[model samples]
Target: MKEANITDRQKKENAIEKIGEFHRFGSILGLERMNELMKRLGNPEKELKCIHVAGTNGKGSVCRFIYSALLANGYSVGIYTSPYLTVFNERIELDGEYISDSDLAAYTDEVLEKVSQMTEEGFASPTEFEVITAIAFLYFARKGCDYAVMEVGLGGRGDSTNIIEKPLACVITSISYDHTDRLGNTLAEIAREKAGIIKPGAPVIMNVDTDEAKREIA
Candidate 1:
């Protein structure tokens, strides 16, 4: 890989700058629209084994931990996180590497094309998050990743990552009442939704525990 005359740090900074312009988190949080968007890209997420992770917090750190471990273990890992710390591509990494600028540009162009068509088809334009999420899936699939660690950008029950079916693993972190207004105010209700990621027979890992926390879902 010839250096693009820019240091790795500079490239990361540039990527972040480019990603900041993509702000689609405000779009509708429904499967119907995301499904259509993914279809436009040929549903790249379906090609890999998904490790669906959900929680009220600690989701990003957990994603990072899983990504690091996978990298150490020699698996090609695709990580999908929210609200990139910098570049949008940072939210979607493959084997600890980000998709190249050219790749991201191409992916972003595809997303914009889909969004324009969707709007013409009477669907509300995708939110910044949706566009980027779609891009992540496409980038991962293009790289031929083996496993994808997905972190819910919002509540698990309706998150875009929930689009996956029968993921190899479903992991949930400590559930809390932070998103009460959107996920429920009570501990049990919130716990139930967070635990929604625990598909039947799928392995569930949790650092959250207890016999008397008012919520035993974890």
Candidate 2:
């Protein structure tokens, strides 16, 4: 048991080290690399039903509420959110249970292998968020989650999470002035970026109070 525990610790440490490698490149906003990574992984994101939530604020709250409602109804739900409050495992959960350390380490190893292969083929390496998003999709799909509530990590358009082709619902909550440098300088511009999460034929739920933002999202 002592040996097993030590091995587990090593795996976790290795996984964290690999994750740190991604931060060196910083956040390059674009879906092309994300799309390529997903495609290489057989597009696990398409295998599950998902709710895509985007906005400058309250996205995590909206995802939590939706996940809670689904779980309360006896459905298996997965949640993928960013900026974890404590640990990286908090960013991915199944039925309110954070992924186990063993699983996280195993998935990180698997993802890193694929990413390395992609690099060999001349594809740009995915960012940290993109890798985590891919792992969440794979986990949710493998776990057979009935619903997955995915929170946008950044602006909707170029964010890594936007690789999801279509979602059960597209939710934009309380869009405001934020990410102005990357999203835009004005409410309309920000709204346009947030609206990018709205997929075709998917119902959109909006809670933005700004008329200009609402119009742009509409």
- Model 2 scores worst on lDDT over the 10 consecutive residues at 8-17
- Per-prediction TM-score to the true structure, in the order listed: 0.83, 0.96
* Candidate 2 residue-wise lDDT, 1-218, digit = tens: 89988887778778878888899778888998898888888889999998999988899999999999999999999999988888778989998799877888988888788899999999998998888898899888888889999999998989998888889999998888897889899999999998999999999999999899989988
Q: Give the Cα lDDT of each candidate.
A: 0.75, 0.89
The digit string of per-residue lDDT tens for model 1 on 1-218 reads: 45763555465555446545555445445677778888888888889788888877789999899989988998999998877676556777888687766677677777778877988999766666777788888888888888999988877767777777678888777766677777777767777767766677778787665433225564
Error of 1 at 205 (Å): 1.7
TM-score computed on alpha carbons, candidate 1: 0.83
Q: Candidate 2: lDDT of 182?
A: 91
